[model samples]
Target: MKNLDYGVIGNCRTAALVSKEGSIDWLCLPDFDSPSVFTRLLDEEKGGSFAFLVSGEYVVTQTYLGNTNILSTRFEAPEGAFTVLDYMPRYRTSEKSHYLPPEVHRYLRVLYGKPKMRILYDPKMNYAGEEAVHTVFPNYIRTSSAVDAEDKIYLYSSVNFDVILSGEEFTLTDHQFFLLSYNQKLVAIDENRVLLDYERTKVYWLNWINRSREYRQYGDMVNRSMLVLKLMSYQHSGAMLAAVTTSLPESIGETRNWDYRFCWLRDASMSIDTLLHMKHQGTAERFIGFIKRILKSREDTFQIMYGIRGERELTEEILSHLAGYENSYPVRIGNAAYNQLQNDSLGYLMDVIYKYYLYFPGTLDEVEEIWEVVRNMVRMVLKSWRSPDQSIWEFRTRELNFVFSKVMSWVALDRASLIAELLHKDNYAELWRKEANGIKEEIHEKGWNEELQCFTQAYENTDHDSSLLLMQFYDFIDARDERYVKTVKAIKENLFHNGLMYRYKAEDDFGKPTSSFTICTFWLIEALFVIGETDQAREIFESMITYSNHVGLYSEDLDFETKRQLGNFPQAYSHLAFINTATLLSEEKKLSRFIRP
Candidate 1:
């Protein structure tokens, strides 16, 4: 079965997806939201790529360098062998600032005898909307988009521009490198600068990993997931992207695709919460800064998502010129779900904020500013908690009083009460606590399906949703409660297919989901473990690890039958869930460190 056999390398400013055979198939220049400079992942024929061609007699292998984001791919043959190291430069320039440029560095080192290879350097600037003109100078090759004159990139290589541009075969006798940058270099690019940047970036990642708290088991996998999460974080604005790519379908050849390059408040807040537990307080604080910057006024409303730089209106656009991954059509950019009223979002944000007040208290001014945000979120929850709206799934066709949304609404009020009590506002705490109890009573009365013997998907229906498994996760219910146990079991029985878990079985706008929503399976695993089914949970967890792509990374979804990844590549939601569930299964029962409600 085909999988997302790709390794991601980034400097937190931008990222690239290099295929297993040493090809850069997908990349967005300058920033995560920018138009693609390379799009081979979407359209194989028209979308351009950069790859090295070797004879069929050679064997190729790919892996990351140690615990860093650097990827190394080796090609071996009887005649010769070589390794290509790929990375993006990221390091601290000062105590308070970082130096991260939008660039991709490929360092080729000859290992044995002279290796003969050909270079295929093709760049489709501006999403390949129009043809590009490639100009080869003595020192570098410049590529510019025909339609958008302002879009351009430069490639400086040591292997002679004419030889590379012409795709001529050559034998490598010495070390070489290629630097692709969004900005033209004012200083000359040379072997010394390339080696220096590579070493510095390597050291920077090593230092980052050293600072994170280590686990006894599955520590390597946790570190890898953390690095992927860090790469998705935008260094400038502190917004965490859901994924690096757009329009990768959940199921191949279907239109269950949407752009995930923007920051969803629910996803970002959950990611920050996970990082905070990993002892990465800097990322959490920066995200808090991002929140404070966006919510400038008390009257400012909350959207489910926003642009990296706080752009509010992300109008959806279809790129008809390109074919999606595996013929999935109508490649899209910008997400309409941002405007959807997802009540679950406030709970995630408030949960993180409450943790901040508890673990990382700041000056009075900072605390007061965050308190204002908490008050605003409480107002929003009070105004909207009674209405039916989109839940965590972001359903497009209809709205319902989803059980998960109601539980999260209760969470928002509960956290608000805790925060108020911590700040010495006893009256506010008492009011919100009463409100939270009222919502809980309503959920138990109407949201539970006595006939089905479990909490249903919504107040009106008896469908099972895997998201309901998070009730204990958000502290909405006790794990040992009979009702909670039955809900978890019922959802697992209905949604578990083959070895993976489906988000739900009910049909929606597109159709009933066919692929496993990866995070849902992790949720089930965590739920089972919490309910004293450790053996079943461990069995499922071990099997699920085998389903990840070649580089031990997961996407948003996976095909049940084929077990191939089938969604946005390297999704943060999937990674965070894996980290959390793996931590629970790997470590002792002292869940207080990562699971504080």
Candidate 2:
């Protein structure tokens, strides 16, 4: 039903994965964290799908509509060619403003071809728990579940066709028109309104892309990555999802599936820093404000992740009823990592605030209200720097004093002290600065192993992890440092294989990892450049970008032997790493110089 050979289209509020066969196999209505309206990605039979399938053999090619999120897929046959235009509506405020309403929850698909096609519109409501109750009309159909009568899904067509319903199936043939609206009134098909929506979406994306400070040397690969980040960004609250879908297996047909629909503080912080580096400001400010509101409400602690609307206590559970994606078991919904004590969130938060100050410089007043929150976070880091944490990997088996966690504990204090001095709120500046140095000294002493000559995954052992390479990113240490150089070489010898990288090779709760993490590979690329291995770094960079899907999209991990994408689709962490590495490695601009103290 659904395969890896697919592309994504969304309006930020919700997204869908469309197969190259012109079928929508995965989508959730209303919001990113909502229950799937079309669950075929997880279950091929019991789950639902909307497909525009051609009967005969054809060659397929897919791409976005120039710079916009509108995806255009073309199929060529011996007799004729077919095209599908798919997009989610995002109406802008005006020709001048870059604003859109939060409730533009509609999926629009238009079919254009001379070939005879088959339409299988199988929609299961409530993630297959409730079958859709459909009432056919003259030219439209209304589908909703028995559980929710008021809310509905309306499918209105633009062409002349009659729906044939047989039991649980609805089949429509010889039609090239489409309109799929959710949580809105179904009205008559307005050609002018559709044209206007498409134009506004195109204009909005083009306007946003025009502001990118990216090097044009990389061309579409870079811009498409930028567009992917924007597409993954939730327009209502500006909480960017780590990926569009969840429960995609990491090792394939295994139980490593986890939900990634929510936002991680680390992922969002890194994304905002990259956005600022690209000279884009709105999304960055909005996401920071999202985190600020969370911290402001709670004040005592920060969680690793949260729902897009800031819902807490994400209790994860498996859907035993529905089959998993491609028969992979345990399709999980909520994320249990929300309960984890990933202290790096505070460090990355402070890092973004400092980066914001570096670029805008005049936004000190905006951050003034949150200064107390920063103070509380720094005190928290100071108190728990020595404590073991679940850390970024969210290890389920054991909690250790991860070196990455400690380094970021240092990063939190480092950025807070700088922010305090920059804003002339020098009350605790010296105190934070002194503590940051203490943490750094301790890391050099304890985190490094004498025999391995590389930074260990934790302070207790010599197991190497690529996340330690993030030391270069945090400015915890520079590449020219002898210890840092040796650490890179150690990782190369231990963890790296065939130009790909793994987070660690040690035993885990789920046995040992068998795939290369895509984000870790990007980290290695940046680390290589920092060590002045420019030629090897460039080669790795060029080779790694090819691991993306047909449309230049990446998942969370890659199969080391097969080179196939794994984990969730269109991962924000992977794309964010790509953007950050691209900007840092760009020859035209030396912006990495600005990140250091």
Candidate 3:
């Protein structure tokens, strides 16, 4: 078996991770919220996969087409070279008929010089331990199995393909091609359908790319990140997943793993802000529509997360069958944290609404119903802001007065003031502003530790937190304030590591600390830029982008030594950070003369 360096290809509904050596290591079919069909990234044995590899040592380089999610990987071996193009056909307005098929599709093509390669198609049904029967055909192999009481199988190739049961292989000469597909139901795919899929997929991606408003200096990176953020989005619901695959492990040989494939309310709101910043109003509108649906459902208390279709019942479970990636073990599915009360979520939601009002002007009546929901949430924040709850890290340890949470609580009221003024409502604008100011004063006086010269992680302790870096970005503190400058310096000295950052160090009763979060590192980059450290910010941003996989994808955490992605692959938080920070940098370059100190 060859070690794989995978890049992702997707439509808005589902995605697949294709390796440089030609392997589909991780993919969730039907939709981003669906159960896995090929999950070797979690468990190598029973977890299914489809791969094609060259016979000898080879050099590999990959990149997505400009401003689109289509991935192209080029491999150069001693014998020859070839380019593998990968993508899923996205829905288009003109081709309404195409939408009738499965919401997702994957295509592979040999686009360049002839190179001899070996292709392998072995798909394990079930999570990681169950067995299925394979029925071989002249042009395809169908493996059928049961998952959670539902019968499911995938059609492996429709064009002169061969397969091996469990452990089989085949070698190929240069310039040859093949096709493989997975679905909830098995159906015969003809050559004409396959050819149309290829054309439709390309056209869909290119058209979507054209819709993006142009950005300078970092246009290429920004466009690619935008496409990635789009792919993670669920088209039917407009809810974006946190990541495509779950339980890749935060630290190798450690158990700090959790499923991250669901849609986080907090992440969804931030995604709206990112799309709006990129001037993609249509995407922003779609996300807002999803949020409205959640509001209309109106469960007495909202969940911190939900499935792509807004399904609320997410029970967590563990799979112990297949061997884990790098032997990480105990691969997991479904997120347990869905039930936790992360108080910051409501505030984040309000922030998106407030920003939308500013970015896209609209009448108060158009969104008044949504404001009623926010009104109820504000009352809840007032009742819960003083109490201890799970912090942003979702640490299993006891909750404390997390500084970031307090900042967002202040935001909840601050944005409420904007809504009140816009709608001419006299209910709580004065009270909300007063309460917001009081929270700011309290955070300034109690949340900072003078002895440490840093804004502490929580009100009662002196430990520095990477999250405090958001203070300036949130406008809770002025970028030029001496105290703000001091906090930035303190984080650099205490929480910084190898130009990256850790959230904070707090030993649980068991004396274990969580690994560094990649999102926090990107947060530092954004903070630096806002504080007018433009050159330093740009250097750090460039260095952080280098940590992505061969095809410009990121995970939740990093394996510092091996430089491998070590969490849920292609985390939405990481991509959102890229979108926000890159937009800020691009804006600064345009306004350098006015903002330069």
Candidate 4:
């Protein structure tokens, strides 16, 4: 069964998903947004992959090296036993620079008797739009797309190129290595250099993990989620990705699939906020810098998402030729939701900026520049808070005055007011506070459903939305308030199925969602915990943890009955929620902030 049983490895430049049986299934080359080099995860026959085929007698197990991103898959059989350590080299070269590269290093170490396996090396560049011609050389094998000469990858290996290309059986009696690079290597490619790179990369991850704050409970899982988030962060532009892959269907054979390679303002902001709570300060600063760079014009309207390098126009396209994941059709590349009027994004960004003001407190000029951003966000919020638009779910068909969007618009004003007070601008703070209070009063009057005794999905409807559980999370309402407590339980009753929670049960453009949104379950757990349902919350958390793939990683959604992972792999939103909920449960106490006196 082709499941999302995969472990991700990256160097912050690019990432690859390695399946449990040792196959490089999904990988984007050179950069995260670049055309995929391996796409077998989407199309089994047409999309290409690189794998190692072993006999049926072999028992293979995969795991990540403790406290690091290096993935190790061991194969044991009566004939022999061996292990493959897969990682992308990432380590500090100097105080101000890192040696991150767009490549992967696979180190094979013999555990005992000679292991017999066949190397299956097949790569389809440019999203498998064209065939790749492989030209084998003595030291390396160069594969280039049939159409574009510039689109190429170099594979340097210690084993014979004939054995790899021909998929012939090879005997492994000693340690060997395979280095796959996007750019041709200038230095000597040998086992010794790869081994050194492996060691340094391992050490770098260990040191990075050592800096994160530890918890009394679920600490290892939190660390792993943080590492996954770090992998999705594009170091070049400081833009955080929603996921590494695109168009993995939410439900098999459903049209709910959308590309998630680019960075969403809300998703990236929430991810940075979670990392900040884990004491990873660099991500917060870098993301804020990315935001500043992209919002260069104060008049520039905020889109929900942008390319990794801050490209504004993400034209959606469908790859008609390739088969989608699990035969799901319309494999997509660019996300069209970029232009949607998602009013909720500004709130998340402003929340992060508020935290940065309190914790990071950079130089005077930097502070002023960010203050300008805060003001611009306020301006946009004030202008559009009354208008109806797409909410956090990014519905493509119709626009609604989503209750969550209104709450977040209020959050934007509230946070901006706090930022103003922090800068000691009393008049500005007072003005923003008035606007925020008006938004909140409107939500209380219109967004809440008196008949249902809870908040609805949108002001005009009585449908329950999982996102409303976050009202208390953002400090919009007290957790113990009757309305919020009722809303949480109402959403749980309506959306929670079998152990996972759906974003909403209502029908949308693609009909009702069948798969559970992974993050909504986390939100439910936290809300339940806050509402004094500690036992149930803990039980649900444990169940949710068990649903994660073998490597403790989650995708965007999971099947309601089968519990199969779906949507984009290693979704940042899912992991961010995991870290936040785990940390909240670990502490058993909420961290209250008195941003407003």
lDDT tens digits, residue span 49-157, model 3: 7765666777877777666676777777665666666667655656333342333343444444456555556555555455656667665566666443244454544
TM-scores for every candidate against the unseen true structure: 0.98, 0.93, 0.89, 0.99
Clashes of 3: 0
- The TM-score between candidate 3 and the true structure equals 0.89
Whole-model lDDT, model 4? 0.91
The alpha-carbon RMSD values of the candidates against the true structure, listed in the order shown, are 1.2, 3.0, 3.8, 1.1
- Clashing pairs in model 4, backbone N/Cα/C closer than 3 A: none
Query: Candidate 2: RMSD over Cα atoms?
Result: 3.0
For model 2, residues 113-208, the per-residue Cα lDDT tens digits are 455455677788877778888888775678888788665677766544443243232222233446677744444565556666778888878888
**Deviating ranges (above 4 Å) for candidate 4:** 591-597
Angstrom error at residue 391, model 1: 1.2
Q: After superposition, how far is residue 25 of candidate 4 from its true place, in Å?
A: 0.8
Alpha-carbon runs more than 4 Å astray in model 1: 590-597
